[model samples]
Target: MTMYWRAISEDQPGPKWAGLFAEYWPAYLKWWLKEGDEVRASYRESQRMLKRHMPEMLPLYDQLCELAGGGDQAARFLSFYCPPPYLSGCSQALWPGKAPVLVRNYDYNPAAFDSLILRTGWMGRKVMGTSDGLWGLVDGMNDAGLAISLTFGGRRVVGEGFGVPLILRYVLQTCTTTEEAGQVLSRVPTHMSYNVTVVDRNRKYLTAMMAPDRATLITHAAVATNHQENVEWISHARFTATVERERYLLHRMSLHRDTEEKFISNFLKPPLYSTAFSYGFGTLYTAIYRPRKKQMEIRWPGTTWPLSLDSFEEGARQVNLPGAA
Candidate 1:
């Protein structure tokens, strides 16, 4: 699989951003569009969400539509407010350091790499993370020294709420602290289940378990995998090892207790860094978000790509993962 990268500065004029959108729109559409009324209905519902709750981002959404020459339809699709796939495999931890940080390992279908994009954008403060197609981010960090990531909340339910990725985009774009971001996550209606981990500049961190039917549950427990406490999605067990994975994270955090080093290294190995590629939950990359320096790093076995707010790069490399065969 091949990964792609793109960078656009906020200082760039609207037209410049439009040009970049134009360049990638076709590829995005080809990969994301599905043939069904359910998909269309979801996009329509997402449009309503933008109009009512997140009107501020409308201008950017409209610009992308104009760039794609798809008018209103493009904006709705890009909103990504549709139902998301049942993704799994993530272990999030609030790393205890001189400056606490957020660490995550995102595992999911390898086919997703076809639409994978690593975006670094500067809108006053730099924002960098991986994006799925032209939609919002799956994980990212801001220059304000704040970072946020998500894991599937291991539930097989879908309802009337926005996709978690768009919500993540909103939080990163507007909130500067863990408390503020937590507030957004609590209020936003997510269509499915998710566990969002947020870490701010002050070393404050939170994990929010969000589902469409229930009020968001905030926890001081710094680690989250594919399930919430006491609520496991029994049916999806084949695809998610939620119980074992969560325990693995908890045990390691307890053992490492005081430093970031021990746990991070451990995450790169079995259980935390998954090898279950055949189940479509392969650990693609482990992301380390360091807000103090406004930097982030993506690591795979034997290789690391380090990035910072001041200097960002756009490139890609194929990764060799366990069970790739």
Candidate 2:
């Protein structure tokens, strides 16, 4: 399944609207119920944390409830906090805001995948219903020269704190530089497991933060799969495979001593999926976000579709849309 979408806002202030919960509630509800009470409790805790860190998100939550048709189940699901676990195949290229792009090889179904792209805001809030259930992203960008991608890190004992989705949103909203983004992460309490990758305007800095019980900065040139540096924790069989695949890729890339551009290009190559050696359900799609050039591009490898990107800039762009702001 190869697909991508582009959203550009000249006067719209970074997508503060709420329509995703309404759009994918049925899928979300189905997955939420599967998790039972433990997941439900965690979601409630996530809601409380969201209210404290980003009160502005409350309206969106309320909107999601209304969209879910307003009932105890909807309320309960809305209150839950866990982000759907994703097997993301991503590559980043730097054009310094002008040419930043991200390519994503998403693992879920195509229909559900399209819904997520449409519902996500540039700088607002987004919730996606996936095979593993619901997940959130704060902001995502793709321009001429920069791109950013994030994925969850699941471990046994990361105590509850702010939901990873909110943190993703915060990064999209406030920071432009890797340094600035790192600073924001430093201040937050990341109680869950996550790996956030940032590719700046120049495409020179590619950094990952593996936040388990606490956030740890990773300086390695490349990271794949799940385990963080020096941390020992057993994960599910599927995740273990995913991590192993990443390690293999990282090692293979290291052998070449490639530049960032070459590294990303190599990483984006289509996976070979077979019953014996699966590439984790085949990557659904890939997207690139460029900051400096204020543009974004997306491609679908399976279908060989055209790459797409949307552009944006500072003072010239409106911070809020007509009624949504």
Candidate 3:
């Protein structure tokens, strides 16, 4: 399967951030409704569900509704189609408790990558109301050498709250450490289930935060596949169980002991459930952010496309001060 990959590093802060819904609401609504009025009705139901669950995010809700040209269209779409227990899949990993990573292979469609990216960036700018750009990060590494990755927990039951995608964006924009990130997660209620794996530069420490209805933090040598072990509670078993399967694969690949390159080689394979999940265009992408080295590498495993920070102004233009790493 083909994939689109990008890695960016900035010495100084970039432009103001934007909201993701600004660009996505219209296109997404139109696309989902193309099937007919029944589909449209279902979409409306979803939006209503979202509003009821996340009343605190009313400002964002209002912005999205306005962007979609008002009425309950945006609210309905979100309630019925977007939240957890409804939209059943995603995956992620984190590095050093700071760098956050994520991979989402939707059951919806495989060809939606290009449109998703364009619309995400557009909506990010518009909805976030930032001058910068729209981006729901697949993965992000922080200045502290803390990295994070995400994966969807395909469970039958999930707490009704804000979507994990938005939570992730909020974490990347605001938090700097595992503790800080965890606090953010604990405070915000999530609509769906997900596993967040965190890693540090030393690679000596790794943790996974599992959110079933609430958040639970766990300590392990490494976490693979779908299940996330946290302190407070263990999430119910997932229907897909990809994480369990991936755990075996990771063991065979020696991922816990291997170098980053080797680990990534086995980690980003095509999805096993091809019928339910598509593996084209956006299924797999990898990013390596080494804060200690003060550099980052973004790779498209399927396409073999690799890009380094040296190529961009955010990386090249800035002088690497001594001890910056």
Q: Against the true structure, whose TM-score is highest?
A: 1
Estimate, for each residue in 1-325, the C-alpha lDDT of model 1 and write its tens digit.
4334334344332565566567666755555455543465455666678877667667766655666676655666677665445466688887755687788998887665533444445334457777754447788887777888999888877887777887887788778999999898888888888999998888898999999889999987788888887756676654566777778777766665756666677779877777777765588888888888878878878877777766775555656676666
Model 1 alpha-carbon miss at residue 21, Å? 5.5
Q: For model 2, how does the per-residue alpha-carbon lDDT over 1-325 read when each residue is reduced to its tens digit? A: 2233433222222222224345566776666567575555554566676677656566656665665566777665555454333333232222222344444334433344432332233333221111112334523543323345655453555554555555655565555566766666665656565566666676545556556456567553434344445334554425334555565455655565555455445534533111221433344444445455554433432232222233222111111111111
Native-to-model Cα distance after best TM-score fit, residue 85 in candidate 3, in Å = 5.0
Per-candidate Cα lDDT values, in order, are 0.72, 0.45, 0.42
Off by over 4 Å in 1: 1-35, 42-45, 114-125, 257-259
Per-residue lDDT tens digits for candidate 3, residues 159-183, read 5555565555555455556666666
In the order shown, the candidates' Cα RMSDs to the true structure are: 2.9, 8.6, 9.7
Query: How high a TM-score does candidate 3 get?
Result: 0.57
- Compute the lDDT for candidate 2: 0.45
For candidate 3, the lDDT comes to 0.42
**Per-model TM values vs. the true structure:** 0.88, 0.64, 0.57
- lDDT of candidate 2 at residue 25, scale 0 to 100: 69
